[model samples]
Target: MTVHLPILEAFVKLGNYLTDFCENSYEKPSDTHSKFEMVITQAQHQNGWFTRENILFALKQWGDLLTEEHLTAWLSEYTLKYEESPKTIGIVMAGNIPMVGFHDFLCVLCSGNKVLAKLSSNDKVLLPFLAQYLIKQEPLLAERIEFTEGKLEGFDAVIATGSNNTSRYFEYYFGKKPNIIRKNRNSVAVLAGDETQEELQALGEDIFRYYGLGCRNVSKIYVPSDYDFEPFFTAIFKFSDIINQHKYANNYDYNKAVYLMSNFQIRDNGFLILKEDEGFVSPIAALFYSYYESEEALRKYLTENELQIQCVVSKQKNTDDVPFGETQKPNLNDYADGVDTLEFLLEL
Candidate 1:
């Protein structure tokens, strides 16, 4: 189980590239300001916000997290056995957020696999740049990494991320191969009365980061019927500035208008609204409906519909109490949708 020197070197280079790209490429607020202006202009032409500033921020954050020690440790732990020879894995990426497919890319590469990554149209820059950097660091990996805008075939296995609608297509197309098909999933947050102010503030990051467009964003809030909404709203109110941002304001006004015209009763406190519903995912900026009369009822509901939920953010002192704001930026150990990706890769 000796670690391969070449692979380790490539991992180090990848980390350096990420660090330089984040710090050097877009270092100043002016840089971000200009990018935001361009994004707004592009957004006006189309119906989507490119979110370039947020992307830069996330990349910088990820670069900081992917330290040399961390990368080396993860590589050593995950790639020890397959260092000499690795699996060839093809990855179909998702464009839900900035480099949303990066974790999958890291898992495959760290598991000692040749990575053939198909970049999402919404995110076409970062991965290719990373591949080129890796090639320069370790020429041996040049053939191991590739970027494409089209379909990829003839890999030992595949990992594809898509919506619930496209999952069926992914299954039919790559079903014959060893594959992991990821469908749409929304995260949830359960608020116990005991959360500290600091924890709640960090939880706001989970709720508002990337304007709630990410799958790991808290789309549903499960609170006790008697629980006061004041603290929660108070803690999250800092994100009110996001409402002033045109992109988020548009979504809020659009949804609010729909509610008004459709005559759907929505309880609004100006910042956010509370509605009654039975699902995990919420409409953008609009929290979905559900209240628990008792902890027993909440437990019953969770047990009954466990399959529909991804991770639960809570301050409880048990497995049920998922930490606040840790949903989207999962640790290396946090497997996606509760599936152990490393284990699956190893088994294949």
Candidate 2:
């Protein structure tokens, strides 16, 4: 029952086909339409958050990562010596965004383990569809992947992703099992006030992608004291069309009203609201900003709240932050909550 690496490589090939079709084809094929094409519609209907753009973005990112070369390179650093000790790894996935819990699923499979996935109701269809596709590509995979509708059981270890409150429940229930229970984590950006207009525009993607629902999306930014926001506003103005989205607009309007009633000063460029606050998670369509006296002070703040922070975006030298706007474009090894998922699975 050793999970051959080529079986996983075939899985990547199937992913490429699915993603390329989604990204390139606009009109549905008359009769030649494949099974994968139907997933886009199914995913959207199942989860309102799974828009065409966001689902396609997630697919494309996986397409880029699931290449034969990329997969080989990524797995080269680790030994596949754990195939002899395969364990059932139960996954309690989160459906905040399209395929948000995919990394854990991928990690478990790549580590030569059996996956018993309990998908979030918000995102139930996509992963199961992908798992079916993988089974089709490599029939042996059918033995390894299973999706459960009821409470998860018969698993030696588990990987669950949820909010801070739900994590306590996970801890209480799965405390004895070897687990990687992820709580809430939000990414942040540190502005040096010297970033280019292009960089700021890229930062808008880090903020607005998934309507700021992802852990990788930046919910807050730290700027230097007295930093001029003219360029920042101007750069992000291009994304004002986001207000056209019904869900996002509703959030924008509601958060704006709450802020106004509370007398908290907020700057609005129509689509997004910018507020000065000392917080990590901001409401949708609103970005919280705080002032830092110096780079050192910002570094100190980041270090102190290291666990709460996912990734830091900046362009300055000598800092350990990720490059501006690359938070969501994480490498395969960039494990969530700073935990190496594959390493955990392999050791289990």
Off by over 4 Å in 2: 1-3, 27-34, 82-85, 317-319
- Per-candidate TM equals 0.86, 0.95
Reference-based TM-score, model 2: 0.95
Superposed Cα deviation of residue 115, candidate 1 (Å): 1.4
Tell me the tens digit of each residue's lDDT in model 1 across 7-37. 6667666666556766665465454335544
Global lDDT of model 2: 0.85
lDDT of 2 by residue, 1-348 (tens): 233766776767776776666665666553323555687788888877788888888888887888877777778877765465579999999999888888888888788888999999899888888787788787877888899999899999999999999999999989999999999889999898889999999998899988899999999999989899999999998888889989899999999999999999999989889999998999999999999888887788789998999989888667667887787788888999889998898777
> All models: lDDT?
0.72, 0.85
TM-score of 1: 0.86
| lDDT of model 2, residue 78 | 77
Question: Can you list the residue pairs that collide in candidate 1?
Answer: 277-289
Q: Which stretches of candidate 1 lie over 4 Å from their true place?
A: 20-50, 75-79, 82-86, 269-271, 318-320
